[model samples]
Target: MENKFKKITSLWIITVLILFVVAIILGLLMRFNQGGNIKLDPVTFYTDMTIHGLTMIGIWFVAGMAAVNYIMERYVRTSYKANLIAYIMTVVGVLMLWGAGFIGKFHAGWTFLYPLPFKIMWEQWATPLFLYALLVLGVGWTIWTVSLMISLLKKYTLSQVFAWQHFKRDAKPEVETPPFVLISMISLVGVLSCLITAAALDFLLLTEYYSNGGFINDALLMKNLTYFFGHTLANEMLYLGLAVIYELFSEVSGRPKWKTSWYVAYAWNLTLFFVLFAFLHHMYMDFVQPETLQIIGQLASYLASIPSTGVTIFSILVAVYGTKINWNLANLMFFIGTAGWVSGGIGAVIDATISNNFLLHNTLWVPAHFHTYNALGNVLFSLGFFYWFSFQLKDGIIKDKHSMLKILLIVIGGIGFLAAFYFAGADSVARRYANYPEEMASGKFWATFGGTFATIYLLGIILFIGGILKRCFGFVFSRV
Candidate 1:
């Protein structure tokens, strides 16, 4: 069973890395086109955008899911069959989606926001095919998430799984819930709910596409549902990475294992509930939404991150500060990823505020924060897991003689790339335009700057990929 898990995970890591590198190039191409260094027609540009965004989101979410599924097997029996099913479905679904984008010329900008799919801007058949593709991926992931959650529940009741006994001071429970288990449970439940939301949204989309003017969707409601799935799922996947860090960080650092304490339980519980409503922040620009809901969005955005981030950072610092422990690439990635997550979390909170949203909504500020956390934060977490997992398959550490140089390149590249985005965002650069007009010379300059740094970042990722690939190849052929 362990061997099976390792092999599948190795394949997933390799596949994800390959796709990720391509997506990064697509993004760089888009930036270069915006900078006027490359010329791509509007249709082609948006087409690349659709594929890049969708592929990045899909790969990272699965990377997190794969990591958790692999790690969870230690405590609970996992369903390898379901894992295999998800793998096959994901592959087929991505192929169909790619066909819609590349062959059918469907370019709805990844969001596929309401009524846009019906615009018939691209091939007539592309829209429905895209929706169907999402449905395929949604079904497989929903099943996988629910199966894992059920497996966890079978071992422990809801209260036990959530570590609710820790809610009280000086309480003793017969079963101690690992921090990883609690977070994974919370994140899986979040993922499951959002998948259902995605299903509902897709259903409405398909209905409208086929209704022949008999049905229409409420734009506001669709937008609400869209971000509910998009934002929540994006964040939940990050939590999945955090779950792996919780389980492995202390051990990798040669410290005592992290235990689920009262504060830990409370913080995660707050996250589980608060994260559901936090997506409302994305709707702030829609004047149709009630002020009350907007207020809720701001509060949710703040509440969601404060407790969890505070507790996790505190725990991490406690584990590291004034203590002697081992440091390796995996733990270093987690540590640096935490800094990135917190930094982006701060930027996100600022943007979530209503007053600030008026100034920053739809600006590059949006992508800046998301890219910060995702590119630097969650991506690093999963990469760290890949390094750890691949080595496990190969039975020892595959020493990288250029470990320091690798860290330097990644840090320099990632920071410079993000810095360009931040500068562009603060200069009021709009998001999603293929090119800037003469009046927005700063936009073009920043686009070029961002493209250059992103290329450097890509180089760093390539180096890391080479290292990961060597171990992955060993894993694929190793008997273990």
Candidate 2:
């Protein structure tokens, strides 16, 4: 039974990785055409880009989160039934939305800005279909989140689950927990906010103001909606990844066990607010937005950096200092994840600045900054968890250290491959455009390099997948 659950979880992880690699390749193809005069069909380009973005956020981020939820449940000895149901629902909904996006049914960008989709898609069916998909996604997310929170509350002490448990306990055993339990609570809040925002934004976009001046005035509303969901999701990822890294290193060579300074915990908590407010920084280019709000947004954006930067640096420095570093795959993952966050953190700080953002906002720099942190930081940290857990699930399941090395090589190689994007962005390369200006024509070289590197990175991923399949097949069917 356990083997069956593990197989499902592992398959999902591999599926997400495969999708991520595909998305990156497609994104690169789209970006490479930015400066070229070759007139590609608008329908094809728009549809592909739309699908790419949706897959990245919807499939990779949300689906990967589902995978994480399942893993956490398995680890904590929680219910698999609910998690599996949610996963199936999410997968079905993802396919529907992705299919629609690919057919150019609804390509008003993921935000689906009010009156925007209506403008582009003359088909009346498009809006309802898009909203319905979002609604389904929201329902699945709500159920999964509620189930997860209930499980965590049942398994762990209230204080650990919510920082201060006020609920009257009726039944279930209380499991002692480490310090970072607040991450789960934060994730729940983030997910809730994401769904609520999406729903509200959809309603506003769909409603007609015929009684008024017939002007669909949802301009700045989508700004806030998208910002909340976008920033909150990223923050959730960072917090969870940080927690995982802490746990991984706690037992490494006599290192301290998940105990850090109060300042560190407080810093991460406060950083969430900073990250939330920083989303407004994206609204700076919106002409309809108030000037003071933009300034406040930028300030919040900068202020948001203090907590994450302080906590992560302090955590890593302490972990690395005076301790024998375990050069194993798990520890290497910790270092690599730390590296990505640090690199992206620096890039993000630069973005918070008003003067600098003008140059970097829509360029390859934006993704470079985020990809460094998310890909290296969150995604890799999750991978480390899989590697650690996979070995513990069954005896000799992971085979040997060689399997671990292959996994790391592939993960790191992929992230390193994306670094070329940073250089291209720094060269004033704009993103999401199929053609480039004369000055930026040479930028294709950097992009091509990144693409080639990404392919090699995929090879590494193939190796990692092979190891998993070998173990799972041996344990599940081959009866080794």
Candidate 3:
């Protein structure tokens, strides 16, 4: 069973790295086009954007899930079949999605907001193909999530799973929950909720498509549901990586394992609740959206970020401050990744503010913040796991001579690439433009700058992949 699990995880790492490379290439192309270094038709540009955005989100989300599933084995008996099924379905779904975008020319953006998909500027079958692709991915992920939750429940009672005993002041429970379990349970609940939203959103979309104008849908409700699914899932995936960090960061640093305390439990539980309403911030620009929701969105945005970030950062600081800790590629990645997450989160909170949202809406700021967290933040978290997991399969951390070089290149490249976006956004450069107009001539320069740095980032990723990929392949093919 252990060997089988390793094989499945190895496959996931391979798939994720390959897709990540492709997505980065697509992103660089878009940047170059905006810089006037390359010319792509508007349709083609949007098509690439659709696939790139969705693929990055999809791959990274699953990367976190795969890591969590592997680590969860320490505490509970996760279903290998569910993991296998999700892997197969994700591959098929991604292929169908790419077919819709690349072949069918369906480029309505990743959101595929209501009415836009129905416009049908592409192949007649593209819309249904895209929706069905989402259906396939959603169903598979939902099952995997539920299976993990069930595995936890089988060993731990509901209260134990949530670490509710910590809530009672000074009370000691016979079975203390691991910090990993508490965070995982919290993140899984959020994940499950948003996935259900995705299912509902896709169902409405498919229903309207088949109705052929007989059944019109509410545009406002659809937009609400869209962001609810997209925004929430994106955030929850980050928490999943954080879960892995709680489980492995200490061990990697040669420190004691983290345990769930009252504050830890309280913070995660609060995160689960506030994150649900935080998506309301995305609707701030829509006049049709209720003012009450807008206010809740802003408040929830602030509240949601505080609890988890505060506790996690405090914990990390205490663990490393003035201590002679074992520093390796894995723990270093986790440390730096936390910084990136916090930095990007601050940017997100700024944009979520009503006053700031008015100015930042639809500007390059949108991508600037998200890319910070994703490219520099969550990406590092999973990379740490990948590196550690690879070495673990060999029973110890194998010193890599080029580890520092890989880290340096990624840091330099990622910062430079993201800085271009931040600077452009501050200048009020609009996003999603295939080419910059003469008035926004500076946008072209920034795009070129970002593209150059992105190349450096890609080189770093390639180097890291070169090492991990070989080990993963070896493990999968070995007869041990």
TM-score of each: 0.98, 0.84, 0.99
Clashing pairs in 3: none
CA displacement after TM-score superposition, residue 298 of candidate 3 (Å): 0.3
Error of 2 at 395 (Å): 1.7
Ranked candidates (lDDT, high to low):
3, 1, 2
Ranking by TM-score: 3, 1, 2
What residue pairs clash in candidate 1, if any at all? none
lDDT (Cα, tens digit) per residue for candidate 1, span 1-480: 478888888888988999999999999999999889999999999999999999999999999999999999999999998898899899999999999999999998878888788998888889989999999999999889999999999998999999898898777888999999999999999999999999999999999888898998999999999999999998999999999999989988899999998999999999999999999999998999998999999999999999999999999999999999788888888999999999989989999999998988888888899999999999999988888777776556635557777777787888887887788888888888888866667988888888898888898888877878888878788766
Candidate 2, superposed: residue stretches over 4 Å from native:
1-8, 31-40, 63-79, 121-127, 154-177, 208-215, 251-256, 396-417, 469-480
lDDT of 3 at 59: 97
Name the better of 1 and 2 by lDDT. Answer: 1
- Tens digits of per-residue lDDT, candidate 3, 1-480, equal 489999999999999999999999999999999999999999999999999999999999999999999999998899999999999999999999999999999999989989899998999999999999999999999999999999999999998888899887687889999999998998899999999999999998889888878998999999999999999999999999999999999998999888888899999989989999999999998998889999999999999999999999999999999998888888989999999999999999999999999998988888999999999999999999999999977976657668888998899999999999989988899988999988788999999999999999999999987878999999989997
Show where candidate 3 strays beyond 4 Å: none
Per-residue alpha-carbon lDDT of candidate 2 for residues 1-480, written as tens digits (9 for 90 to 100): 265566666655655666776776666566445424234566556666776766766654554454446546544655567666666777777777766676535677655555566675524565566666776776776777777777777766655554332222332224434445555555565666666777676566656522345756665776678777766666666666666666665564357675534455465556645666777888777878888988988888777776666676777787778767655666666677777777787888797688888888888888788777776676667666656555655762334447555755666566655677788888888765555567786566766676666666666656655555555444445342
For residue 14, model 2's alpha carbon misses the true position, in angstroms, by 3.9
Worst 10 residues of 1 by lDDT: 393-402
lDDT of 2 at 141: 68
